[model samples]
Target: MSTLAIDKRTLRQDTWWLEPMLVVLGLGAFAVYSTWAALQNGNYYAAPYLSPFYSPCLAINCEHVSVPLFGSWYNWSPAILILWIPGGFRLTCYYYRKAYYRSFFWSPPACAVRDAASGYSGETRFPFILQNIHRYFFWASLPILAFLWWDAIIAFNFGGSFGIGLGTLVLIANAALLSLYSFSCHSCRHLCGGGLNSFKTAPGRYKAWGIITKLNEKHMQIAWTSLVWVGLTDVYVRLLAHGVIQDLRFI
Candidate 1:
């Protein structure tokens, strides 16, 4: 009976569900706000009057802008939204596999409880199996970063005849967000660390890995910061496009 009590305590300690639940709820709220902001800016499709060149849409509210074909006419903002779905999942995703088995899918723990007189059965159930996805997502986000950079350049073109566009500021914000995302990724740290095989053997690779590990140690904070910044980047572009916000130009 005493051994069973100890086993239950261990199981409870390993399966934490609250943290991930909060993260999901928070991200959902942000998604709703971002969508509303995008619609308000006439960015649900495209506005050539707001941005002359590189407009994703040929006409406003046109059927030509299809989600399956081009994925919404608004350029950078939509990209940000798409990236965010996986981004949120990657954050605090380590517990997903564990929580799923212990709390919902599998219910009872996989290991058998035994007294000291008998041998203990090891835990056969897998924990953190879903976290393997983070590796793939880390690599996938890199190209998205490049696309965002390109969009930032186009966003700078101001619609009016004379004034320089506010796209540069938007570009800078996107760059910052990309930096945060790249730095905090788990797979990026492994890549920086010199892949799986040479991570410990190569001296130079080890040094790089150490640096990235240090950054990844603060992954939670960086994740939240990047998440908020990316959302703000979308809103900023939308506001500028809609003439709700003005970008100040020095030169």
Candidate 2:
């Protein structure tokens, strides 16, 4: 519990800063890799498998995961256009906000620890207020998740024939993990049951909200798992695209 006492005090403990340091390293590494991957347009898709970065491939030049719906009028990386949805959603996520706030900003880094900044204004100002748009991102992510599910299903086929391969399994796991992450989101919880006046009125939605609420309890775990799996999915597809590794088949 925070006290109103004006005392220049700090937690007398070992490893207080460890959590923040790990957060910095983890987030920084992911940022660098995602930026590098997004710039590589042609390298994103492998035959019958699409990197999440380039799912619903909109460019005409998409050779592997070729949908080409918008027509290739502009010569630009497709990720720049599509990455914003999930990127924005995760950026504004309530869990992530607490994460970066402590890790990057050192704002009261740990319980009973003082914030590094002396004077602070809360999220009512400038860009901090932008987080209120998270729910909108949650809305946008629904369609994107549908698209990803479609892509994962599409991965099971090779040359118009039903088949199974290592990539198929990877894509399946990636989609499943990501779905769990989204379902477990706090916004999703609210959408399901937060506004309800009485659970006795809506049995179906109430049941769903109950399940989602359980997922919400493990939100942090799902969030990190999805993050790691996404990167792994991209790496597996990249290797296949480059012929660095071949997809192993079963059935």
Candidate 3:
């Protein structure tokens, strides 16, 4: 009698697919919501609170003039121009790459699991090679982060006077979380100490490297938190702008 051998993807498995499934759900939901919000072009700004998606609003139709790079003849969402900065930053992010590659591509969805594809070229080819520009995206994101902080600072100003509101806190938290995420980036760490021959020789850079390393340790957690928080921040601003909810003043 001839026996047939059955091939298996992984032998040691304890619900390994759960994590990837959850990643898909989270990323999918955020993508859908963010795309819809960006296309609205309205309800992204309310006094003292501007959605991060619409900040640095470069469109001719923007309620708040932010550079006004586009001509009056131009018509579309201002977000399309700026969202690419943050979007690209996250798309090429180290943690995000692993998350999407596994969940979306099923490229060894979990450790010990077989990749869906038969051949593994690894990010050496055309499109994946673009991920090497993540450092450039990191640099571009700094100004956006600065603008977010500026927005958060202005959120405390109610008609040129100091004030606080729920939206103010939200914006502040959004900026803070994003700052953590950005500073904790692998590129940021490399920038701080990439070429140092010895940490003892470069004390200041060594310190900065140490600090960024600490943040990098929590990079994955901060990445997820910042991702969720930023989306919620935009939603909050949208609700305020649309008059769906009134921002409660704390002081």
Candidate 4:
């Protein structure tokens, strides 16, 4: 027995895995819930309110007529094709990438932990490199947000007059949170002219960039809240569509 070297990566081991564990739990729950909701494919629309899960309902045969913004013809799960826009944007989101890369892939789950792999090459090759398309997805996601806002706006139109309901408020919250999440994105921040050479010339972009920079500070928090709100919005619409609950109108 010659000499042995101890891997002294961490000494104080008080709940070091807590953060990663929480991330796994939170993301896992969202994944499970979203999957179930998508597969159910029922109760996604009700009168003036359409579930975020099935907006811009492109299929003519969409169960609900108020939706079908594109005259649905696909005759499949609209959410399947439609949800991917926002889904891909979030999946490639810089903040979410960091959270999942560490927790889900366990590339050194915490500051002092050792990674499962021997070396860190970064996002240089193959699948990891695909993250570069996040900016493209960001652009693609903008139009969908317009659709979501349309849904939120129409939600207030109960029989052509001003109206409010539990669903209306939920849709409003969902749209608001999603807007925050999307606009607060690092990509959005950069698009707002963050890399500008001088603010003296581009006053408009500078103003917009300044607002985005402030919002970007809380991007991670808004991301989580928006994710949760989108799901809850769909849930509320589901229950209302299924007659599991009433709309609880207040206008």
Q: Could you say which candidate leads in lDDT?
A: 3
What is the full ranking by TM-score, best candidate first? 3, 2, 4, 1
Q: What stretches of model 1 exceed 4 Å from their correct place?
A: 1-25, 35-128, 153-167, 194-201
Q: Which candidate comes out best when scored by TM-score?
A: 3
Error of 1 at 234 (Å): 1.3
Residue-level lDDT tens digits of model 1 in 77-142 = 333335354444554244333433333333323334222224333343244344556666666666
For model 1, where is the 10-residue window of minimal lDDT?
45-54
lDDT string, candidate 2, 10-32, tens digits: 74568888988888898788888
What are the per-model C-alpha RMSD values against the true structure?
8.2, 2.7, 2.2, 2.4
lDDT head-to-head 3 vs 4, winner: 3
Report lDDT (CA) for all predictions: 0.51, 0.85, 0.91, 0.85
Q: CA lDDT of 150 in candidate 2?
A: 90
Model 3: per-residue lDDT, tens digit, 182-238?
999999999998568899888999999999999999998999999999999998988
TM-score of each: 0.56, 0.93, 0.95, 0.92
C-alpha displacement of 250 in model 1, angstroms? 3.0
Q: Per-residue lDDT tens digits of candidate 4, residues 1-251? A: 43345465556568888999999999999999987887776678888889888776776677754355554446567677688888899899999999998898888788777887888877998788989899888898888788888888888998879998888888888888988988999998888988888989999999999999999999999999999889888888888888989899898
Q: 2 or 4: which has the higher lDDT?
A: 2
lDDT (Cα, 0-100) at 169 in candidate 4: 84
**Model 4: how large is the Cα RMSD against the reference?**
2.4
Q: Which residue pairs show collisions in model 1?
A: 156-167, 158-165
Clashes of each: 2, 0, 0, 5
